[model samples]
Target: MIDDAGSTLTAELSAYHPLWHLKRINWLEGFGASVPEDEPITTRVFLIDTGVHVGHPYLSKAIDAQLAIDFSALPFGLRYVDGINKPIEFDPEILDHLPLSANDKATISQLMQRASGKLCKAPLETALHTAFPSHGTACAGLIGARMPGFFTDPLPSLTDGKPALAVPYWGVDPLSTIIPVSTSLNPTPGQLILALVYALQNQADVIHLPRGISVAWMSDNGEYDNPGLSLKTDQDEAEWEALEALLFAISRTVPIVCAAGNSGENSLAYPANLSLEDKGENGIISVGALSSAGFRSSYSNYGPGLTVVAPSDDATVFNRYQIRINELGRRYRLHDYAGYVGAGLPRVDFSREAILSTDIPGQNGYTGYSPLGYDEDDDTFAHANDPLQGAFTLFGGTSAASSIVAGVVALMTRRAKMKGQILSGPQLKQILRATARGTPADTKADDINGDKASLELLFGSGLVDAGKAVGKIGA
Candidate 1:
């Protein structure tokens, strides 16, 4: 956790690492502001995406499990109001279809029992089987995973007697609360609308949508046009209208931080694109990703709707490293290596540049401990015998960037409440835009369909300046 001295347990970690992304955005400077002690307000950030692994040690304290809602349990095409009235029931028979062990099924049943009602519960084993179990968990961790005070086993540090790794990890806003809302990987328009409604009812201070919907149809010139303008069917048009209405209502109060898709195109996905139409204060905050080298991330989508950019993995730097130690049997024991070197042990580098966050524990999640030996070329590393093997992994994309922005918003909200003032969604958005730093020097304007665009068109206002934004809250 961040203390008064502004130093964390993972402070001595490597300079060339994933955590550097936080420093790039001046996160610590922003966190230094004083919040009112007599009247504290809990900033609740509603994370609408694949359910989080609430049981993860790093995220256990940050998440509010009782308020978590799983819309995936509701049948498709179910109306938003009906889902609220209906109780979500997990069917045991569905587990039978999955190729899981009997023990896994039993554990899932236990989790289901605990998750009954509005309480959100995501079984680690079940999530591991999904396409991306770490998706929501990683995003949540980026927003508010608490820094553990103690470790079960000491981690391997590059320096002798100093406990540090390739990167130290923690949430951007550890004091904020996260409300995990579970949904299918590709949720329908109705399901997304339902999630937004749930967040609004819960009085969420900030809503982070790590995913995006492309409601706009592509034109013959290879550009995404306005939403609901080229819909082919009445049903599609109706769904778009419903989504717009809900967004319009929510934007008036709560800031909806959205990822500017990963399509690498010049167009933003729906809702994120809505930022373009949002001239008011309370509106969508579209976030794009910036590479480690201070440039717009190659995969991040950019256009007029982008509100700001944040530091994210550029897929160039390697964040994952494996080292062999002599103390094989001792748990979490790092050998006192001579100097900072690991006594000439064979080290492995596998993972690429990405944000580090909590993942599903054990071998089920990404960075699983594989027994078949290490494959340096593969993204997943074999931590079978490593003492530093914990519930953490490297993740990237505009989604990660969006989560970081949401965390900043949470901090700003807390700061506002501390000052005995309430900043509306639009006020916060305006502050962020006003305080944002200029775009990176490497960022260049792009020509979209023979039309020259300015840097603002590509990177929105500019990079998000957390310190400036937080300091300006209530001013």
Candidate 2:
């Protein structure tokens, strides 16, 4: 089915675009900034997203072939390629219809039902059908690539009025294995422990979790101080303790990166801030968001726990639009702003305005669904088409921020792999933080508490200089 044009979404999404401000940064004037093809570092990033679409042009280049191996051991029906997985037969509405045997699907479904709270889960079948246009897919696009062999032929022969599947020139195997978990997966205390164990069993180098205790444990009252929302409370303390224990255990193996959270509040999001307590270790990276203006977006939660900031598009206007409502209920559209993007916002800071990366081939259910129209309040409307800019639209949230940081971690790891340097997680975090550049003296400061501060909590480490980070590769 044809989808809405991205141009409209792009127009609406301009303000929220994370790199919106990067466009404003005078990279030419920067002391060390240069748009060079090669950097001191180029690493392999393992993107943990819903699934990536193999058909998009951008991802075709980043797929790492050397690591590709057949993982038919995973459900046999699933196919991989094109920097995305090929769609399979499954109904979007049916959450439990894997072609695997009844017992098998049941087992997987049950596992996901329990774990769904932490991982961003969706039907693998749905991801394939839509070509994965969800937040997870967009994340993968920001990292690695897809190989051409996955696409046997661009022009497959048509049969029964349907295009034939492309044939691969070489036998394709799984690259950077994916262990799918539900986006809604909320792990029980026991389950969280088990899953962490499983992830470690798989030797996952870095675990990217989108949600944590703070946002997950909030209450209906909507107060941050309430024990319900605070991680220190009785209901959440156990979970927090378990997560911390797991983090400590896992840090011994792989580093963990979490989104700082999208809540525009005074405190740092839990777990993200928790990791920042200086464990004297390298197992955690807490990332914040930076706007295109090279400043922190207004909405991102910020505080001391922040390790660094990345290109998490602070806002996607296409995702959320606010309409003004009067006392009489008369309503009119003001400006539709993307959460983090605006004039003077942080830009991608690269020569190419768009960060050239992977793209999902089809629609994941989130976008392209029939629009979620105005709510009872009439103050907002979420046009399904309006929620996305392209199959590869821009989005922001600690979710995007988390993945961006993970990608950088991957690249750093890869660079180290090449240089024969063996650095641990604590070491990496220190290097990244130490190399960070500060905000300029004349740069506009954040208006917090009726006064401006040179170093605001939101955009930590100033603007992330990937080039500088790369330059500091060996250091």
Candidate 3:
């Protein structure tokens, strides 16, 4: 019902590959869910965004790259500086939507009609910003293919042999050994509360944000005290009171996942509105989106300070939803628009689409580096392209759903170091809210808040079942 013209809906869609267009020894014999090489599954994960392509080839040995962490020392120009920059397009009438393969629906409807005419734009280059491995090099090749020693170069090499899917930018800096600190722009709750007080005096476990604030720094006046106003007006309470003192000074000790925003409404997203009441810092979780049939996500952004939920993979209706509950079971409803497609609202690209991960390089041609003035390493600068391959890519928001839930919380800290019981940050968020995945059934209740408080506003402790959060961190 939606093909009025645009070349008959760009002749039915698909055709837009730039994450290096494919070459990493033939893209790891098909990406995503496949891990068995004697059961690998490493885990490091830092991805502060606007940087990471730490030598692609699916994730060059799992990227540590000799401490190269760059919290904006320069690069990160845009391409979504790391999360929710806007895309949406697909309302060609929704007969159950999900189609786009004709080269990703004529390259995402010619990049949303060239971003609605201004020649296309909005925070795009993913994989948490840049260094090049596009899509954070396929999400660090899905966490070095399921978390064992979390690669950066343990075995990956096969041009004429076999093991393809690449990785190798060993410079290093997965949070500069744990947060030394640097700066350029895009961060100012007094530098995210001085990098959460240098990552809680250094024993850092997680902080990742994949971009989720700047809609012109929110608060179009919702009562924030209007200094200028545009985000809608209320001045958004002085940036939510300096993000509630940087979320009670870094959830008391690391743990932060932000990104339940791509302008998806139901309001209350900033630092998950500093978790409304438990003002005692429980260690912040706040994810949203869910789609691969898990439900919820009509652009995610509900209330009661949302706690969890995942998979955000909508990619223009490609599917992935999450946070279930229906058939009189209850709990559903989350919309900005339901039927009539076009105005059927919901944004964060309907909870991100075609996900995948890891990919950086929005700029990387360094050599004559310059922190403030300039130094050496010339050859007209501009390096970053070694054995990493196109790195990896695929897009959508909540900034790749907060680095796929911080790479499943670094695979639950490598399954709590194979079980010795040392899990921190409020005991890994009380074992991810006592093993989430509940739903009572509200079947998208009029899209969200027309009843049942839109099921706790919008899936607070409902979805996020990454194999039951990796089987409750492997029991």
Candidate 4:
């Protein structure tokens, strides 16, 4: 079932793309059913994560570069001022300009100091080496990537065995504007709060936090365990309380969608877990990942706070060489690989599925440029060049799932705006929950609790159905 390299058995490349998920959520049908209009209302979804590549072909049309902000430059920690050491503070003029309470400002200053200490001990830049540099680009593409116009000829399907030409990679709400807010690779609570405030100020219709924060303590077994919401320090409490207040305020006007986390634990990460608290009509919408099989993904965190599930990758193995060759043959028409023989081709394990979205262009990001020497069998080195190889990649996790939900929310916002109505965050959540479909039969039912309660714990309301949500909003 698995090879020594951990690569899964190979299957057709179509199985790893997002079209299957798109169809399952009824994306096309829902938008197709909407009333025809000369001009559809444009909505904005603020994405706070690693910076996006604004120049990517699929994302260039949707990104609003003028409104984008790089918050990674925010200073944190102590600094000597006039030979006197003091906590680094925001300029008095700038502090006065903000609409925050005095207490919140003080807490922010304290957080900045704490974040600085953490950075000093272990810089986040080192961690970025193994991390996805194009994380923000991937998330943004899921929300608003427009279809590229390069493919004049029909390409092989990227979803299933259907004979019809596969649709090119596109996002749920291609017309929606993306407000990119760049933060540190691992953002601290203060940075996240500041980003939220910025998004609010910019009039973002929906906010997508495709990352999570966790507060953990070392156990007796010398392992760290998360203590959700039960913060140990006064500073931690103050920061979370402030964040909760801001989220509540924002939710009154626009929906905030957050990832449930990638750790396969029974409890959710912080902020996302905050959704469990009773916020009475308005709260953060926590999203979990669903495998192509319609079951909870093995790596997706679960809990009562989870608001809904969305399709994502669920493979245990990845054969990079095979994936690249398949893409080149199918999409780029570079099919002269001597290494790719009939039945001898490598197989991927666990039915290897992934979400196909935009990536950072060039060899810097995932799906690196050209797969020429990666495989040993290909002697035809001269014919192995693919110019657009790095433009797209297969990405997954609750991050991708949350982006899908955010895009759906954007579509709903546009639909409501077209009908001359403004739906509150709570109203949008209500519509999504009411219209969600049930979990698949293959979903694990081992929870001691009854089926309905257990399903809610694992999948929140259920799988997010875009068509139903949009139709409800329009009605």
Q: In TM-score terms, which candidate is top? A: 1
Q: Which scores greater on TM-score, model 3 or model 4?
A: 4
Candidate 2 per-residue lDDT over residues 1-475, each given as its tens digit: 0023223323322433333422232211121221122443333343333334433443435543223222211332123334443322222223232123454334333443443222222233433564333554555554333334432433222222332322111101112223432221223343444444444544455566655443443446644432222334553444544445556656544667777777755567756776665664546777776654454554566777677776544332122222111222212234333333454443322111123222332333334423243332235443334322233443456665566566555555554555667766676676667756665631234543332444646566654545455456655
For each candidate in the order shown, give its overall lDDT on alpha carbons. Answer: 0.66, 0.44, 0.42, 0.65
Give the TM-scores of the predictions, in the order they appear.
0.72, 0.56, 0.28, 0.70
**lDDT tens string, model 3, 1-475?**
1122223212212122222111111122112111223445443444444344443333444454433233332343222222322332323322123222344334333322432211122223353333332434443343333222324243332222333333321111121122113223354343343333333433456666555544343445633322233343332434334445545555544566666676557765566556554656456677776654445555666667776665554422212222222212111224422332444343222222344444443333211112221212112222233233222234445555555555555556555555544565556665666665556531133244333456556767765444455456545
Give the winner by lDDT.
1
User: Residue 184's C-alpha lDDT in candidate 2?
Assistant: 17
TM-score between model 1 and native: 0.72
Which of the two candidates, 1 or 2, achieves a greater lDDT against the reference?
A: 1
Q: How many residue pairs clash in each candidate?
A: 2, 58, 115, 8
Q: How accurate is candidate 2 locally (lDDT)?
A: 0.44
Question: How many collisions between residues are there in candidate 1?
Answer: 2
Candidate 2: minimum summed lDDT over ten consecutive residues — where? Answer: 166-175
lDDT of 1 by residue, 1-475 (tens): 2343344323533353557667767787676563454555699999988777777777888888767777665431111232234465555454454334564445445444444234433443445444354678889999988766423244333345454433345787888899888766666455566676667667789999998865544346545434324526644445456566567557767899999988767888877888876444446899998765555665678888789888776532211222322222222133343243454533322123567777766555555533333434343344443344546766789989999999999989888888878777777888888988765463544333343557887688788877889999766
Ranking by lDDT: 1, 4, 2, 3
Clashing pairs in 4: 8-348, 8-349, 9-347, 9-348, 9-349, 10-347, 10-348, 14-158
Candidate 3 stretches greater than 4 Å from native? 1-48, 51-77, 80-184, 187-207, 210-236, 242-278, 285-405, 408-410, 413-427, 430-474
Per-residue alpha-carbon lDDT of candidate 4 for residues 1-475, written as tens digits (9 for 90 to 100): 1122112112322354446667667776455443235665768899988667776767777888666655554332111112322332333333344445778767755554443211111123422222344788889989988766522244333445552323356787877899777676655456677677667666789999898864443235534332333335666557756666667667767799999998867777766776764755564788998877665776688877788889887633223322223332222244444444444544322224678788765555654534332422222341143345556666899999999999999888888887888888888888888888865552432221122237788888888898899989757
